[model samples]
Target: MIGFYGDIVFETSNSRILTFSELQRSTASRWAKHEVIGKKPTSEFIGPDLDTVSFTVNLNGQYGVHPRDEMNRWLIKARSGTAETFVIGNKRIGVDKWVVKSVSQMWGVILNKGEVVTGKVDIELEEYVERL
Candidate 1:
Protein backbone atom coordinates (compact mmCIF):
# COMPACT_ATOMS: atom_id res chain seq x y z
CA MET A 1 0.00 0.00 0.00
CA ILE A 2 1.45 3.37 -0.96
CA GLY A 3 -0.86 5.51 1.15
CA PHE A 4 -4.39 5.98 2.40
CA TYR A 5 -6.93 8.66 3.05
CA GLY A 6 -9.19 7.42 5.82
CA ASP A 7 -10.42 4.04 4.59
CA ILE A 8 -9.67 4.72 0.93
CA VAL A 9 -6.44 3.05 0.03
CA PHE A 10 -4.21 4.16 -2.84
CA GLU A 11 -2.77 1.14 -4.49
CA THR A 12 -2.34 -0.78 -7.75
CA SER A 13 -3.44 -4.35 -8.21
CA ASN A 14 -5.32 -6.67 -10.48
CA SER A 15 -8.63 -5.69 -8.93
CA ARG A 16 -8.04 -1.96 -8.35
CA ILE A 17 -6.15 0.65 -10.26
CA LEU A 18 -5.66 3.66 -8.02
CA THR A 19 -2.30 5.41 -8.01
CA PHE A 20 -1.30 9.01 -7.42
CA SER A 21 1.41 11.24 -8.85
CA GLU A 22 2.57 14.82 -8.98
CA LEU A 23 2.12 15.08 -5.24
CA GLN A 24 2.59 18.55 -3.81
CA ARG A 25 2.51 20.05 -0.34
CA SER A 26 2.00 23.64 0.71
CA THR A 27 2.43 25.45 4.04
CA ALA A 28 2.59 28.99 5.23
CA SER A 29 3.11 31.25 8.20
CA ARG A 30 0.72 34.00 9.19
CA TRP A 31 2.26 37.45 9.31
CA ALA A 32 0.91 40.90 9.95
CA LYS A 33 2.41 44.21 8.97
CA HIS A 34 2.10 47.20 11.26
CA GLU A 35 2.84 50.75 10.18
CA VAL A 36 5.23 52.62 12.41
CA ILE A 37 5.06 56.36 13.02
CA GLY A 38 7.13 58.05 10.32
CA LYS A 39 9.06 54.85 9.77
CA LYS A 40 8.96 51.68 7.78
CA PRO A 41 6.37 49.04 8.47
CA THR A 42 7.19 46.15 10.74
CA SER A 43 6.14 42.62 10.16
CA GLU A 44 5.10 40.37 13.00
CA PHE A 45 4.73 36.64 12.86
CA ILE A 46 1.34 35.57 14.01
CA GLY A 47 1.31 31.81 13.68
CA PRO A 48 1.50 28.95 11.26
CA ASP A 49 -1.14 28.57 8.63
CA LEU A 50 -2.85 25.34 7.79
CA ASP A 51 -0.97 22.99 5.48
CA THR A 52 -2.40 21.65 2.26
CA VAL A 53 -1.70 18.66 0.04
CA SER A 54 -2.57 17.93 -3.56
CA PHE A 55 -2.06 15.07 -5.99
CA THR A 56 -3.21 13.61 -9.28
CA VAL A 57 -4.60 10.13 -9.76
CA ASN A 58 -4.85 8.27 -13.03
CA LEU A 59 -7.78 5.91 -13.38
CA ASN A 60 -8.05 3.37 -16.17
CA GLY A 61 -10.72 0.76 -16.77
CA GLN A 62 -8.13 -1.72 -17.98
CA TYR A 63 -6.59 -1.61 -14.53
CA GLY A 64 -9.93 -2.36 -12.87
CA VAL A 65 -10.80 1.17 -11.80
CA HIS A 66 -14.33 2.49 -12.09
CA PRO A 67 -13.93 6.21 -12.64
CA ARG A 68 -17.49 7.22 -11.87
CA ASP A 69 -17.59 5.31 -8.64
CA GLU A 70 -14.27 6.76 -7.52
CA MET A 71 -15.31 10.25 -8.42
CA ASN A 72 -18.56 9.93 -6.49
CA ARG A 73 -16.72 8.72 -3.43
CA TRP A 74 -14.45 11.74 -3.45
CA LEU A 75 -17.38 14.06 -3.94
CA ILE A 76 -19.22 12.49 -1.04
CA LYS A 77 -16.31 13.02 1.29
CA ALA A 78 -15.86 16.61 0.20
CA ARG A 79 -19.51 17.39 0.75
CA SER A 80 -19.71 15.68 4.13
CA GLY A 81 -17.05 17.89 5.79
CA THR A 82 -15.46 14.88 7.36
CA ALA A 83 -11.89 14.74 8.65
CA GLU A 84 -9.79 11.72 7.80
CA THR A 85 -6.30 10.56 8.51
CA PHE A 86 -3.87 10.99 5.64
CA VAL A 87 -0.91 8.68 5.66
CA ILE A 88 1.84 7.84 3.17
CA GLY A 89 4.17 4.95 3.57
CA ASN A 90 3.41 4.64 7.27
CA LYS A 91 3.92 8.35 7.92
CA ARG A 92 1.21 10.86 8.66
CA ILE A 93 0.91 13.76 6.22
CA GLY A 94 0.51 16.66 8.60
CA VAL A 95 0.45 17.48 12.29
CA ASP A 96 -3.19 16.47 12.42
CA LYS A 97 -5.72 14.74 10.22
CA TRP A 98 -7.02 16.15 6.97
CA VAL A 99 -10.22 17.00 5.13
CA VAL A 100 -11.03 16.79 1.46
CA LYS A 101 -10.99 20.35 0.23
CA SER A 102 -11.70 19.90 -3.45
CA VAL A 103 -11.65 17.45 -6.32
CA SER A 104 -11.21 18.03 -10.05
CA GLN A 105 -11.68 15.36 -12.69
CA MET A 106 -10.94 15.03 -16.39
CA TRP A 107 -11.91 12.17 -18.64
CA GLY A 108 -9.21 11.33 -21.13
CA VAL A 109 -10.97 8.38 -22.74
CA ILE A 110 -14.64 7.40 -22.88
CA LEU A 111 -16.36 4.42 -24.45
CA ASN A 112 -19.26 4.62 -26.82
CA LYS A 113 -21.64 3.61 -24.02
CA GLY A 114 -20.54 6.63 -21.92
CA GLU A 115 -18.19 4.69 -19.71
CA VAL A 116 -14.98 6.36 -18.73
CA VAL A 117 -12.12 4.21 -19.96
CA THR A 118 -9.37 6.49 -18.72
CA GLY A 119 -9.44 9.55 -16.49
CA LYS A 120 -7.39 11.81 -14.29
CA VAL A 121 -8.44 13.25 -10.98
CA ASP A 122 -6.88 15.96 -8.88
CA ILE A 123 -7.52 16.06 -5.15
CA GLU A 124 -6.80 18.80 -2.67
CA LEU A 125 -6.55 18.25 1.06
CA GLU A 126 -6.26 20.61 4.00
CA GLU A 127 -5.10 20.08 7.53
CA TYR A 128 -7.78 19.40 10.14
CA VAL A 129 -7.00 20.76 13.57
CA GLU A 130 -9.36 19.98 16.43
CA ARG A 131 -10.35 22.55 19.02
CA LEU A 132 -8.13 22.61 22.03
Candidate 2:
Protein backbone atom coordinates (compact mmCIF):
# COMPACT_ATOMS: atom_id res chain seq x y z
CA MET A 1 0.00 0.00 0.00
CA ILE A 2 1.08 3.51 -0.77
CA GLY A 3 1.42 5.43 2.42
CA PHE A 4 1.43 9.21 2.62
CA TYR A 5 4.05 10.58 4.92
CA GLY A 6 4.89 13.94 6.50
CA ASP A 7 8.12 15.83 6.86
CA ILE A 8 10.88 13.92 8.61
CA VAL A 9 12.68 15.83 11.35
CA PHE A 10 16.15 14.88 12.46
CA GLU A 11 17.07 15.76 16.03
CA THR A 12 20.62 16.31 17.03
CA SER A 13 21.84 15.50 20.51
CA ASN A 14 21.90 19.24 21.22
CA SER A 15 18.18 19.48 20.45
CA ARG A 16 18.00 21.33 17.18
CA ILE A 17 14.73 20.67 15.38
CA LEU A 18 15.16 20.91 11.62
CA THR A 19 11.90 21.07 9.71
CA PHE A 20 12.42 20.44 6.07
CA SER A 21 10.64 22.67 3.61
CA GLU A 22 11.69 20.51 0.68
CA LEU A 23 13.66 17.36 1.17
CA GLN A 24 15.56 16.63 -1.99
CA ARG A 25 16.72 13.12 -1.17
CA SER A 26 17.82 10.63 1.48
CA THR A 27 19.82 7.39 1.06
CA ALA A 28 20.81 4.43 3.22
CA SER A 29 23.29 1.76 2.15
CA ARG A 30 23.47 -1.76 3.53
CA TRP A 31 26.68 -3.29 4.81
CA ALA A 32 26.75 -7.02 4.04
CA LYS A 33 27.40 -8.70 0.70
CA HIS A 34 27.73 -12.16 -0.72
CA GLU A 35 31.04 -13.30 -2.09
CA VAL A 36 31.84 -16.11 -4.52
CA ILE A 37 34.38 -18.73 -3.49
CA GLY A 38 36.48 -20.88 -5.84
CA LYS A 39 33.52 -23.05 -6.80
CA LYS A 40 30.36 -21.75 -5.20
CA PRO A 41 28.91 -18.62 -3.62
CA THR A 42 29.75 -17.87 -0.05
CA SER A 43 27.38 -16.68 2.64
CA GLU A 44 26.88 -13.04 3.30
CA PHE A 45 29.93 -11.54 4.93
CA ILE A 46 28.89 -8.73 7.24
CA GLY A 47 31.21 -6.40 9.02
CA PRO A 48 30.83 -3.91 11.81
CA ASP A 49 30.53 -1.14 9.25
CA LEU A 50 27.53 0.98 9.99
CA ASP A 51 24.93 1.82 7.40
CA THR A 52 25.37 5.21 5.73
CA VAL A 53 22.54 7.68 5.93
CA SER A 54 22.68 10.87 3.93
CA PHE A 55 20.11 13.45 2.90
CA THR A 56 19.49 17.07 1.96
CA VAL A 57 17.00 18.96 4.08
CA ASN A 58 15.44 22.35 3.39
CA LEU A 59 14.45 25.09 5.85
CA ASN A 60 12.47 27.44 3.71
CA GLY A 61 8.75 28.37 3.84
CA GLN A 62 8.62 28.12 7.57
CA TYR A 63 6.94 30.83 9.63
CA GLY A 64 7.05 31.80 13.32
CA VAL A 65 10.25 29.85 13.68
CA HIS A 66 13.73 31.17 14.06
CA PRO A 67 14.94 33.79 11.63
CA ARG A 68 17.37 33.13 8.85
CA ASP A 69 20.43 34.06 10.85
CA GLU A 70 19.33 31.86 13.74
CA MET A 71 18.79 28.97 11.38
CA ASN A 72 22.28 29.47 10.07
CA ARG A 73 23.61 29.37 13.59
CA TRP A 74 21.89 26.10 14.27
CA LEU A 75 23.38 24.62 11.15
CA ILE A 76 26.81 25.56 12.33
CA LYS A 77 26.10 24.29 15.81
CA ALA A 78 25.16 20.86 14.46
CA ARG A 79 28.73 20.05 13.61
CA SER A 80 29.65 19.42 17.23
CA GLY A 81 30.68 15.87 18.00
CA THR A 82 27.50 14.30 19.26
CA ALA A 83 25.04 11.57 18.35
CA GLU A 84 21.83 12.49 16.57
CA THR A 85 18.62 10.59 15.85
CA PHE A 86 15.70 10.65 13.46
CA VAL A 87 12.07 11.53 13.97
CA ILE A 88 9.73 10.11 11.35
CA GLY A 89 5.99 10.77 11.56
CA ASN A 90 6.58 12.72 14.76
CA LYS A 91 7.51 9.50 16.53
CA ARG A 92 10.75 9.31 18.46
CA ILE A 93 12.60 6.58 16.63
CA GLY A 94 16.09 7.00 18.03
CA VAL A 95 17.50 3.69 16.91
CA ASP A 96 19.95 5.16 14.41
CA LYS A 97 22.74 7.43 15.54
CA TRP A 98 23.97 10.07 13.09
CA VAL A 99 26.66 12.68 12.82
CA VAL A 100 26.58 15.74 10.64
CA LYS A 101 28.89 15.45 7.68
CA SER A 102 28.20 18.76 6.01
CA VAL A 103 25.77 21.63 5.87
CA SER A 104 25.54 23.79 2.76
CA GLN A 105 23.02 26.48 2.06
CA MET A 106 20.64 25.84 -0.81
CA TRP A 107 20.16 29.02 -2.81
CA GLY A 108 16.51 30.00 -2.90
CA VAL A 109 16.50 33.37 -1.22
CA ILE A 110 13.26 35.24 -1.60
CA LEU A 111 13.73 38.97 -1.33
CA ASN A 112 11.40 41.63 -0.01
CA LYS A 113 12.71 45.11 -0.75
CA GLY A 114 16.24 43.88 -1.14
CA GLU A 115 16.13 42.00 2.18
CA VAL A 116 16.09 38.28 2.63
CA VAL A 117 12.61 36.88 3.01
CA THR A 118 13.17 33.16 3.39
CA GLY A 119 16.07 30.78 3.22
CA LYS A 120 16.87 27.10 3.09
CA VAL A 121 19.60 24.69 4.12
CA ASP A 122 21.02 21.57 2.53
CA ILE A 123 22.62 19.24 5.02
CA GLU A 124 24.31 15.87 4.81
CA LEU A 125 24.57 13.37 7.66
CA GLU A 126 26.28 10.02 8.07
CA GLU A 127 25.34 7.19 10.36
CA TYR A 128 27.79 7.11 13.27
CA VAL A 129 29.49 4.44 15.29
CA GLU A 130 32.29 4.51 17.82
CA ARG A 131 34.31 1.71 16.31
CA LEU A 132 34.39 -0.60 13.34
Candidate 3:
Protein backbone atom coordinates (compact mmCIF):
# COMPACT_ATOMS: atom_id res chain seq x y z
CA MET A 1 0.00 0.00 0.00
CA ILE A 2 1.43 3.39 -0.92
CA GLY A 3 -0.98 5.70 0.87
CA PHE A 4 -4.64 6.41 1.51
CA TYR A 5 -6.96 9.39 1.30
CA GLY A 6 -9.99 8.76 3.48
CA ASP A 7 -11.43 5.42 2.35
CA ILE A 8 -9.66 5.43 -0.99
CA VAL A 9 -6.64 3.20 -0.86
CA PHE A 10 -3.70 3.57 -3.24
CA GLU A 11 -2.15 0.24 -3.89
CA THR A 12 -1.17 -2.28 -6.51
CA SER A 13 -2.62 -5.75 -6.73
CA ASN A 14 -3.49 -8.38 -9.28
CA SER A 15 -7.03 -7.07 -9.35
CA ARG A 16 -6.43 -3.40 -8.56
CA ILE A 17 -4.19 -0.90 -10.29
CA LEU A 18 -4.32 2.28 -8.26
CA THR A 19 -1.18 4.26 -7.53
CA PHE A 20 0.06 7.82 -7.16
CA SER A 21 2.89 9.92 -8.55
CA GLU A 22 4.33 13.44 -8.52
CA LEU A 23 3.46 13.84 -4.87
CA GLN A 24 4.15 17.34 -3.59
CA ARG A 25 3.62 19.06 -0.26
CA SER A 26 3.73 22.75 0.57
CA THR A 27 3.87 24.72 3.82
CA ALA A 28 3.72 28.44 4.43
CA SER A 29 3.94 31.03 7.15
CA ARG A 30 1.52 33.93 7.47
CA TRP A 31 3.31 37.23 7.67
CA ALA A 32 2.09 40.77 7.59
CA LYS A 33 3.99 43.81 6.46
CA HIS A 34 3.93 47.01 8.47
CA GLU A 35 4.53 50.19 6.50
CA VAL A 36 7.36 52.43 7.60
CA ILE A 37 7.85 56.13 6.85
CA GLY A 38 11.46 56.01 5.67
CA LYS A 39 12.85 52.54 5.95
CA LYS A 40 11.81 49.17 4.64
CA PRO A 41 8.55 47.79 5.88
CA THR A 42 8.72 45.60 8.94
CA SER A 43 7.23 42.16 8.92
CA GLU A 44 5.13 40.56 11.59
CA PHE A 45 4.51 36.86 11.84
CA ILE A 46 0.83 36.06 12.08
CA GLY A 47 0.96 32.33 12.27
CA PRO A 48 1.29 29.21 10.15
CA ASP A 49 -0.84 28.66 7.13
CA LEU A 50 -2.48 25.35 6.39
CA ASP A 51 -0.31 22.83 4.64
CA THR A 52 -1.28 21.60 1.19
CA VAL A 53 -0.60 18.36 -0.63
CA SER A 54 -0.99 17.55 -4.28
CA PHE A 55 -0.57 14.31 -6.19
CA THR A 56 -1.64 12.45 -9.29
CA VAL A 57 -3.19 9.02 -9.46
CA ASN A 58 -3.36 6.79 -12.51
CA LEU A 59 -6.24 4.36 -13.01
CA ASN A 60 -6.42 1.57 -15.55
CA GLY A 61 -9.14 -1.06 -15.86
CA GLN A 62 -6.69 -3.60 -17.18
CA TYR A 63 -5.02 -3.42 -13.79
CA GLY A 64 -8.37 -3.95 -12.01
CA VAL A 65 -9.52 -0.42 -11.25
CA HIS A 66 -12.68 1.32 -12.39
CA PRO A 67 -11.71 4.87 -13.27
CA ARG A 68 -15.12 6.49 -13.08
CA ASP A 69 -16.07 4.89 -9.81
CA GLU A 70 -12.86 5.93 -8.14
CA MET A 71 -13.12 9.45 -9.44
CA ASN A 72 -16.67 9.70 -8.13
CA ARG A 73 -15.49 8.85 -4.66
CA TRP A 74 -13.15 11.80 -4.68
CA LEU A 75 -15.76 14.14 -6.09
CA ILE A 76 -18.28 13.13 -3.46
CA LYS A 77 -15.88 13.84 -0.65
CA ALA A 78 -14.85 17.18 -2.09
CA ARG A 79 -18.42 18.28 -2.69
CA SER A 80 -19.47 17.40 0.83
CA GLY A 81 -16.49 19.13 2.46
CA THR A 82 -15.48 15.96 4.26
CA ALA A 83 -12.40 15.87 6.45
CA GLU A 84 -10.56 12.58 6.45
CA THR A 85 -7.32 11.20 7.74
CA PHE A 86 -4.49 10.87 5.24
CA VAL A 87 -1.69 8.40 5.71
CA ILE A 88 1.37 7.55 3.68
CA GLY A 89 3.76 4.81 4.56
CA ASN A 90 2.25 4.48 8.05
CA LYS A 91 2.57 8.21 8.78
CA ARG A 92 -0.14 10.79 9.05
CA ILE A 93 0.02 13.70 6.57
CA GLY A 94 -0.89 16.74 8.60
CA VAL A 95 -1.47 17.95 12.14
CA ASP A 96 -5.16 17.14 11.83
CA LYS A 97 -7.47 15.66 9.27
CA TRP A 98 -7.30 16.85 5.67
CA VAL A 99 -10.04 18.02 3.35
CA VAL A 100 -10.22 17.48 -0.34
CA LYS A 101 -9.56 20.90 -1.83
CA SER A 102 -9.89 19.85 -5.43
CA VAL A 103 -10.05 16.92 -7.81
CA SER A 104 -9.17 17.21 -11.50
CA GLN A 105 -9.72 14.31 -13.87
CA MET A 106 -8.31 13.62 -17.30
CA TRP A 107 -9.73 10.77 -19.32
CA GLY A 108 -7.02 9.18 -21.40
CA VAL A 109 -8.35 6.01 -23.02
CA ILE A 110 -12.00 5.32 -23.76
CA LEU A 111 -13.72 2.58 -25.65
CA ASN A 112 -16.58 2.74 -28.13
CA LYS A 113 -18.96 1.95 -25.30
CA GLY A 114 -17.83 5.17 -23.59
CA GLU A 115 -16.11 3.19 -20.91
CA VAL A 116 -12.98 4.76 -19.52
CA VAL A 117 -10.13 2.27 -19.59
CA THR A 118 -7.35 4.60 -18.48
CA GLY A 119 -7.34 7.94 -16.72
CA LYS A 120 -5.53 10.20 -14.32
CA VAL A 121 -6.74 12.26 -11.39
CA ASP A 122 -4.96 15.13 -9.75
CA ILE A 123 -5.93 15.71 -6.12
CA GLU A 124 -5.27 18.60 -3.81
CA LEU A 125 -5.70 18.46 -0.05
CA GLU A 126 -5.50 21.06 2.70
CA GLU A 127 -5.13 20.67 6.40
CA TYR A 128 -8.41 20.74 8.31
CA VAL A 129 -8.52 22.20 11.78
CA GLU A 130 -11.60 22.23 13.96
CA ARG A 131 -12.72 25.44 15.60
CA LEU A 132 -12.60 25.54 19.37
lDDT of 3 by residue, 56-118 (tens): 988888998888888888899989998999999899987799999999999989888889988
lDDT of 1 by residue, 42-91 (tens): 99999999999999888888887798778778889999999999989999
Write the candidate numbers in order of decreasing TM-score.
3, 1, 2
Say which prediction, candidate 1 or candidate 2, comes out ahead on TM-score: 1
Give the alpha-carbon lDDT of every model: 0.89, 0.49, 0.90
Q: Model 2 segments beyond 4 Å from truth? A: 1-18, 21-44, 90-94, 110-115, 130-132
- lDDT preference between candidates 1 and 2, better one: 1
Candidate 2 C-alpha lDDT tens digits along 11-39: 33333444544433354444555666676
Those runs of model 1 whose alpha carbons end farther than 4 Å from true positions after fitting are: none
Ranking by lDDT: 3, 1, 2
TM accuracy, model 3: 0.95
Error of 2 at 38 (Å): 9.6
